[model samples]
Target: MQLPIAPEGKVRFVPSIPLALQHAFAMFGSTVLVPLLLGLDPRVALMMGGIGTLIYLISTKFKVPSYLGSSFAFIAPILALKSSLGLGAALAGAVGSGIVYVILALIIQRTGSDWIHKIIPPSFVGAVIVVIGLTLAPSAISLASGGTHFSYNAFWTAMVTLGVAVVVMVWAKGRLGMVPVLVGMIGGYAFAALRGQVNWSIVAKSPWFGLPHFVHPVWNWQAMAILAPVAFVTVAEHLGHLFVAGSITERDFFKDPGLGRSLMGDGIPTILAGLVGAAPTTTYGENLGVLALTRVYSTQVIAEAAVFAILMSFIGKLGGLLQAMPSPVIGGISILLFGVIAASGFRTLVDAKVDFADRRNLVLSSVVLAVGVGNLALPIGRFPVSSLAMATGMGLILNGAFLVYDKIKPEAKDAVEAPQEAAL
Candidate 1:
């Protein structure tokens, strides 16, 4: 039997529940993958994700539809910070980023979004986006390689998974197209199971219901210094997401909920997630894809999905099942997922009509990509600025400098031209 399709607006409770479940499944793979990669408790991350969505709904007054999930931008920083200062320190840094969001929200409230554009132009953002994916390439490749030498079965399984995902995403019609990630995950899992790669013991051992392991944040100034700077990338990410959501729904969320409220919504939840030992949450593009495919923009449906996620968090067996997935499978998905992210960055540049021929743009973009991908670190007192933060800071400074130069050069040219006009 075919399920009744829910339209854009509110629908009956029974119809909305299935749509909500679909949204949850759409984001489940990526959401679970982050916690596993970071070695954090998958259950805690899932729980926080649902709770974060609720908080975001409240912060935005339920006017905007969004789902908060594990953010990819923080993966590199968190992994680095964790190796040095411990997971508590990493959580602290993630919390610090949340504070940065609130501060940006205040600034946006006082001054409109124009200042944001001045600080970080499309070229700069695009560069950062590109850097993000490119920097993670080594990690992705290592996982896919699987052990000291390449495993032939693992390689083919990954390829099959990626191939299935591409076909589903590019050619599938209606709601089916929206779930490419889930479909690909299932395909990968089935192939791995056939090859005896999946370990079923972990699933059998896990309990049906239990409280997720939760850890408290610890303060570390150095960690904060290293991680806080990432807020720049995340904020830019949020803005781009807002723009996409707005375009799809034909509702100007930036103007309606206003940028301030939206940032606060995302920021507060991030802080909460960090406090509870979960990776920071951000707006998920997968959910937006689902919305676009289903043409259902109802906040209530998203809310219901959040409730479902919270419920799943208590299901220990489910968490174990997610963790039991083979590394090669996850790596295969990351290959496409990260590439899509880089492509999205290019799309941002194109959509904004960023002029690459402009020297200022070229210089600013070059600096960000070079510093970011090259992993250049600059010492700042006790902390060294590197990774995404260093790239973001450099981009902003260069872009702002260019803006100032542009502002002054025209007037200086006019001053010289004024004499010629007088002579005429």
Candidate 2:
């Protein structure tokens, strides 16, 4: 087996570009999808994604290898705010969400992250990671099926893409194996073109150079209230991603960079995204999958990918070309990537040696899977705490209850010994 690359590892420029492109390909579909769904400009989302990633890298002192992308968590809230108020108000809400992250970071900086562990133990963390992967399953499937309805062409295209990816993952050797996702996408796109699915007109019509549409945020207290609470969901997800990434790289990022710094890294980019009229940014699990597959955790490679993304945003033809990628092809790639993410979570459980025989462990895992996989939403005021956030919250509450039980419960062995001594 090839040796894994460390975060600080250096690579020659020629090979590094392809490695960076692999990471860009891994992030491309979903980064743009978030903005498209929310009726925002895809170019702005791509630009913010690259910019946010760079910001995050700097904030973490380039110790953590992650690619920041448009967040899906705030899609509903942003859309709702946009409809009821205006796009400006919705952007304000996103800014407010970033403020929440910053405040949390400040608190963590002072009080430390010990409380975070107390509320979210290892067992709960594993379950929350699993929830994050499972929550994304539907989106993968929807793309595979060609949106709301299933199409035979789409299914076949997805199968071809998935098959190529699997083959590359299992059989390919050396550098080729390191980019199964990118290779699979190329193969899938080729097949899609042959089948007359590729539309070249959009790319042709797009100008070679352009700038993203930027809008300033309009602050409204009501809009802030509606969108700010959703930050809690993304915050829980942010922690889970950090844990998973740390596990993959076999480095304690939380301790090295510290959770406080990581949160600030994430929050700062999100603030920039809102200010520039783009979707909020989050650490992408797709890129994490690439890191796991390639065993390459080089921050330099990620930075290169960010640069590519920023360049892609400014080049209208390039952005349009990516936009024209068939949904089925994206779906096919997603099947493998999303599955890897979930498998990583299971690996976390195994690595931690979590004992399901313990009732506390059993309850935490079972309840989290049920709530998270089932997509149960429990509303908190105007915000509905659902999916990953709800699952994480429920797991934390359950774990906290068990901890309290352990604290308050009397020692039965001591009571029995006392009675025996009295009788003697």
Candidate 3:
């Protein structure tokens, strides 16, 4: 079957512009939302996301078609650190997280990534993904309800936004189908505007052109201790995305660009994000969605999207407009997006054919869900480990324990009988 556009396919400038814009629009809402949630500059997030994608392309030798955006995984830890120690310290934690990725990449380069699979396994990784999504559920609810106290206006607006998005996702055709998130945001924003929820003065007062406000990181050991561990979870998520993309494009991204290079591509941009006071970046599922929807795997189009994002960041008014988006619209969109994220985890398990009948798999998933959803944290000295990190650690430990047990335990009688019966 002919792909709509092959990974290396060349296209003339005019048509590629819209194709690239579609990719950018697909990623825009989620990319900016992360920084907004963490009280960082959305412009910086946009800029970093663009720069990160470019860096990722270079690091992968342009063999992989992917875009990096602000990661949702680091949100809880970063927010916790920001509240306790300040933004600089939180950003320092981001730096530490990036370092973790780099270290993992280096290890994978030498020994390969088979160890990663053995340690985490598909079941454990799927559980962690579900945990990451569910852990953030309350935040979405809080945003939808208009913060600490519930408001009728906020709830209705959120519902309208979500309703529009759902409709678009299920029924929209062609290119429109690829950008449900962006479409949903616009729908929500429009509803909020009609209700006078938007504050237009922020946009009016902002300049047309300017650079994003860049903050410098302040090194903090405690902050680092809190945020760095989450990289393990993101790495697993990254691996899953690469596998999905490879399947869609009918290419072995892991073998071609290689997993080590892919991880480094993701890591370096995250390091840059930490230094420049933006959220840590990850390979975006939104980009993958566009690729699947359009069947276009063109690297040039992805690169064009990256450039478009970079250009958008410089429009000071655009940042102001994004900032002026009301809580209800954000809440409405988050409701859908976060739920989808959680559902995707279940999909992952199904795709992996994770056997829940197996005692070990059952225990691994059960414990992960309990720890992560229950928000169980373990404090070490001054630093408190997050539920997501703790859950991931526990899952790994349990899987490792199960592996050891399997090696030492006697084989099932049915297994031995089956071989003898077959011979008879």
Candidate 4:
């Protein structure tokens, strides 16, 4: 049998640039939303996202079809940093967070994959992921309500954004099929912009090719303290992204590309984003949903998207326009997307085939949800652990430690054997 070839003489091995542009456009709205909420530069975030994609491609030898972008997981920390240290200092903290990723990548390089799974179990991972979504509920509510110390906008914009997001997800078609998040943001913001309150001065002042206002990390103990816990939670999120990408590509990226190298891809780009006044970077799960929707598995497309983000960064007017979007508009969109994220976590537990009939699984999951959602918190002596940090930390420790202990106790001999026998 002979294999067919394209007129361009391209093979399955060839990368498609146009497809990547479509995907980037599809994902870009969500990318900038993180910076907007955290009081950072949306244009810089785009540039960093684009550059971060390039860095990840370089770090991973251009093998994986993944794009690195702003992480929602760090939203809490960025806000906290801004409150205590100021925007410049907050960005410095974001830079510090990237350094932590580099360190984790090194650890993965030195050790093996076994250590990661053994240390952070699926239960812990699920809990941490859940904590990530639930921890932001207050912020989301405040945004939906009309903004607060964190973000500013009327509650109505948030409702509209959220409603539009849900409606689009339910009824969108063809070109509209994959980018519910972007659509919701645009739809909600458009309504808010027309209200005659959106500011265009910054957009007018923004230059097309001006140099990025790069800032170095100041030594901020408080910012560092609050953000440190996020590293543990986010490692799991990154791994989950890697796993999903591997599944789509039909290759264990964790093998050849390696987790450490991939992590450095996430880390290095993040450091650069912060330097230029962007926000913390990570793998966007929404983009993963896009990959699933589009089935475009080539890294070239992701690289192109990265370039779009980079070029878009220099468009000062556009950045100003995006910056001017009302907080309620963003809040409206967040209303649905954030809930979906939490739902995805719940699905992870169900898909893992966790034996809920067993009391052990029940106990672990219950505590994970309660501690994260109920606002059960702690004071780290003189330091005040933000709800986000405390919930994330507690979820990991409670879920990880309990699951490991349960696994070893041998109490589930029958439970463990059931799945094996069924396979036979």
Candidate 5:
């Protein structure tokens, strides 16, 4: 008998149930991760993430299965907003993030990729990412040190699991490597279990399926303003993800699927999430990396993962298991992912061929990096502020300012003469 034909280069007939389950699991793992870190309901992120993915599929014509959900980058901003205001207010800011992306999509429809370069330069975007990652360093440390939902015993368990996960991730080949985060999590949980660090009562007392924490929107002026800057950074991130997916599919998505549509896709869900008290929405880069690794591009696979995530939201035990994961393990993974994200900025700079010696580039890069990492801030009227979100906002504005100024000014006479002399 002839072998079953491979459903190569096609998206139909493959989004089956089993594949769907696997996809759901993966999606659940990735999206639930964000809320877990931020002390929000992981279940909320999962359901929203699944819903967001469905929206994205519809927007992108069900071609791209890339799951959208809680963005790790949005964590610091959300946390800062919560501390400054409250949860409802912080979520309101998340809704703003979707609006920001929709606006960018409109810009893209008008100006295309060139518009991206206008607002989001290598220096600016890089600085924003750096701020996003490094700003969370404190939380990583505190959590690893048993600050939240973890004990000293749990810390060691987490550390061991994290260490093994790191090793597996760094050393493991192929499919194993693709799931380092999950591996580290499971490994950590196993150790925590052995050490009796996990409280089974939390797991046993909860129902198998129940309604998750579904938050509703309430206006908060302070939080809205505080979290507004995340729009800039996460918007840039949105463009980056679309570009990546386009590159992967070898199709100009901006042409057919339409960037505006995709943003609308991501935006609608993000808005839904914000209104429903879910975390921020985003396309997970790591999951894309996994797709690349697994050679699995089936949107059905992602759909499966999304369903699993949706189902898991109702399971207290599953949520508890995620909670049972140690802080140090997350800390370890964050360190790697954070550095990689920062390095992505460096790569962007290199690709753009921005001159370090050029005064314009130097000023832009120096100011952006310094202000970003150094936590520089600009006070607007009465609010007291200094944070990753503010730093990123300041850096982006400055970077754009430098770009404009450099473009407007002519070369100095001395520099012009010096170039002529060299030519001579």
Candidate 6:
């Protein structure tokens, strides 16, 4: 692909500061929302997001433009683990997931990204991306449906939230256009408040300043089994995000900081968050959205944003306020957020020029979408894999098989044709 010419020059500190703040604001909603959904401390998520971003920047020598935050891909597994094994065990599973990233980094260091690309191409990556969102579709529906049962009020509020967000994202311009998610959440919250669904007591009773609860992971094999496979999902996500960032910046980051280093940058913080019993972190796409909106690719700007998130984590009231957000409001916002994620995956395929007309591509895409959207599960001995994991595994295998077949078939055909040509 021909790279576009990136605008050259260093970002001035004066403008960098506010741009960083904008980045932070851009990511705040999703970062906090993840922890709040799983009954984890929102403050801890904010703190880890900052710490993780710093870790990513430092690991990459402050060259990569990324901010780490709570991963939505891990949400279903974490929530499931939390329900069955307890939060500590759930976090321990996250640690295992991080270890998977570290392991992939080690492998990349040994063989490089080519080995990965051979087995998993853009179509597979795009399928995994869509699966990640589709796998979470039921959760989004359940959340928007009300606590345990369907509520008309909750459904409408969610619709309102999604509607407002779409409107803002379409009509709003400049930096303002970058915050449709936040605006949508607020709009949903206001609608819920009017319907007397919001509980203000928790926010009122919360302290203004306090330390975020930081606990320790409790090792559990079962939890690890469930959460660890998610690392593959994150792996695909990391590569896709890097590809997007590289396209935007006109720099082949796969060479500069390198994919191995990038994996390490993303992995280390996730391990750190898990060890401290916080939600696992991944590079924030919302912040990436901010990067696209602003066209500022400076790592310094993202670093500043990380710093702000770290500082904000100490504010107990802010965390409390996030937790106090009405369920319906959260549900409403979730519908849009999760749906956008799935859509982004589809867009990635389109951007990658994946040819669906090819039989192999069609089969792979169809199978992945069906399995993922349907949330089908297959048991491997005593262990069961989620739809996303199964889809990723299937995509890797199918892509690799087809790639090998494509390579070998031409050689076989040439060998047969050479004999015919000699006869002629």
Which model scores highest in TM-score?
3
Q: Candidate 4: minimum summed lDDT over ten consecutive residues — where? A: 1-10
lDDT of 2 by residue, 1-424 (tens): 2459888787778888988998898787677767765667788988889989999999899989999998866764576567767889899989998998999899999999888666666677677667766777677788888888789999999999999989998999865765677688789989999999989897798889999768889988766766766676577668878988999999998888999999999999999999988899999887998898788898999999999999889988876766677889878887886677677678778977987755567778899889888878666566444456567667767777776765687473244334434756
Q: At residue 289, what lDDT does model 1 achieve?
A: 86
lDDT of 5 by residue, 164-195 (tens): 76797689986566666677777777776777
Give per-residue CA lDDT, model 3, range 145-214, as digits (tens): 9799899999999999899999999999988887787888899898889889999999998899999889
Task: For residues 97-118, write the lDDT of model 1, one tens digit per residue.
Answer: 9999999999898888778866
Question: 1 or 4, which is superior by TM-score?
Answer: 1
Question: How much is 417 displaced in model 6, in angstroms?
Answer: 17
Residue 89 in candidate 6, Cα distance off native in Å: 2.5
User: Candidate 2: where is the Cα deviation over 4 Å?
Assistant: 1-42, 70-97, 146-149, 213-252, 274-279, 284-302, 378-385, 404-424
Q: Which is superior by lDDT, 3 or 5?
A: 3
Q: After superposition, how far is residue 104 of candidate 1 from its true place, in Å?
A: 1.0
- Give the top-scoring candidate (lDDT): 3
Ranking by TM-score: 3, 1, 6, 5, 4, 2
Q: Which residue pairs collide in model 3, if any?
A: none
Q: What is candidate 6's lDDT per residue for 202-315, written digit by digit as tens?
A: 888788988988888898887777777778778877888888788777778898789999999999899999987578888878877877877777787787888999999988
lDDT of model number 6: 0.80
**lDDT tens per residue, model 4, 102-185:** 888898899967777766666666766776677777777877777545434476667777877788789988657677788888
> What lDDT does the true structure give each of the candidates?
0.83, 0.80, 0.87, 0.72, 0.68, 0.80
